[model samples]
Target: MVRQERAIRTRRAVVEAAAAVFAERGYTAATIAEILERAGVTKGALYFHFDSKEALARGVINAQISDDYWVPRELKLQEWVDIGMTLAHRIPKEVILLAGIRLSADIQGRSLFGSAWPAWTQLVTDKLVEAKARGEVLPHVTPRETAECFLGAWIGTQFMSEVVSDWTDLNDRISVLYNHVLPAIATPAALIRLDTAPDRGARVVEEVERQQRESPVPTEA
Candidate 1:
């Protein structure tokens, strides 16, 4: 049991190190030697744990999105918005990596679409669909279309946020969605007060960060 636990720790360290390296240098420029040095592990260990760099990159993204869990199937639209804002707060680095990947030529959408994107879209679509069904959203609103627009804007905003290091006003973005964007699709009454929701959501988001920090998960190893 102790040996297994140590192996898990080492693998987590590798993913984190690789993620940091990739975020700073990008995928094409990042090398296995850099990842090894960052991880402070022997080359053999990294090779044993991951067959290649591509697998390691995928692992990094999986850690970011699902944390290896199945996606949530049910939520109100407001809840979905809360989750996005909170995730950005907790794992800004990982979110940046995703943005970097999308912009990078080395990685393709198909590599992650079945595993990650569908799960994300499903979560967004489910909430939008539920909100429309519940009359929280206007009947004319197309859940799929709204989901795409919301997700595109959210991802784009995260990327732009990265380019500007000093600006950390995700709440402002949420406010725009609530007051302007979402209202255009749904009723104003359906809009959530993010200032209030973040208070509760912050706790949940912190718990997620704590879990990822304290209990390291096994990766390729």
Candidate 2:
């Protein structure tokens, strides 16, 4: 068990190190040696988890979407909003997500390893489908189409924010995105109830942490 846990930690470290390198230097320019130096792991350890740099980039992309920190909400639309806002909040801080964004935007790297957009689009599509089932979305809204459009807007917003404000205004840009897009797709009741505030991501994270702390731990019977 200890060895398995160690391996998991080692793999995670390698991925994160790779992310940092990839975020700083484009995939074409990034070197395995730099990732290893950043990871503080041996070559054999990195190779054991990832066969190549391409594999490492793929791992970084895969790690971009995780719901472990999220708490479920009664409103599916609000959950969707939380996902975007939380990502906006985290992107500037998290190397992995930043790397994913960088790789997805790199023409050469994207051609080689594929972009994370499809996965993100599918994630949003699934959430929108759930929201539609819950009657949170308008009747004319199509989940897949909406997801694709929203993701495109999100990517553009991130890029513009990065260029203009160095991502200092990403949360606000995402809030504005939601404000503009939601009114078109979300039901009036859902739109009214949803919190699209720029500071919502931080608040939601705090709330999730509070809930986790207040809830009793489960034990085997």
Candidate 3:
């Protein structure tokens, strides 16, 4: 158990180090030596987890989608909003996420390792499908189509935010995105109940943490 936990930690550290380097330098320019130095892990250890820089980039991309800080809500639309807002909040703070964004956008890297956009689109599609099933969305709204359009808008927003404000205004941009887009696809009731505030991400994270703390731990019978 201890060995497994240690391996997990090591792998996480390697991925984080790679992310930092990739975020600072484009995937083509990032070096394994820099990542190794940042991680303070031996070559063998890094190779054990990630055989190459491409693999490390893939790991960072995979880590971009997680439900660790997500909490269920009465409104599925609200949950979808939370996912975007929380990611907006986290992107500036997390190296892995930032790296994922950079790698996904890199023209050369896209050909080599593919992009994270497909996975993100799928996630949104699944959520929107659930929301449609619950009658939170308009009947004519197709989840996959909506997801693709939203993902395109999201990538454009990120790029604009990066260029215009160096990503300091990303949360606000995402909030505006939700405000404008949700009204078109969501039911009136769901739209009214959804929170797309710029600070909604921070609040949702706090709520998730509180729920986690208040929940009872399960024990084996």
User: RMSDs, each prediction?
Assistant: 5.1, 2.5, 2.6
Q: Model 3, range 1-53, lDDT digits (tens) per residue?
A: 67887889999999999999999988988999999999999999999999988
Residue-wise lDDT of candidate 1 within 89-144, one digit each (tens)?
Answer: 55453543453344232445336322345556777788788878877788888888
- Clashing residue pairs in candidate 2, if any? none
Stretches of candidate 2 off by over 4 Å are 212-221
Q: Score every model by TM-score.
A: 0.72, 0.94, 0.93
Measured with C-alpha atoms, the lDDT of residue 151 in candidate 2 is: 94
- Which candidate, 2 or 3, has the higher lDDT? 2
Model 2 lDDT per residue over 66-120, tens place: 8855768899988899999998988888999999988888887777788899988
| Model 3 steric clash pairs | none
TM match of model 3 to true structure: 0.93
Q: If the candidates were sorted by their lDDT against the true structure, best first, what order would they fall in?
A: 2, 3, 1
Which of the two, 1 or 3, has more TM-score? Answer: 3
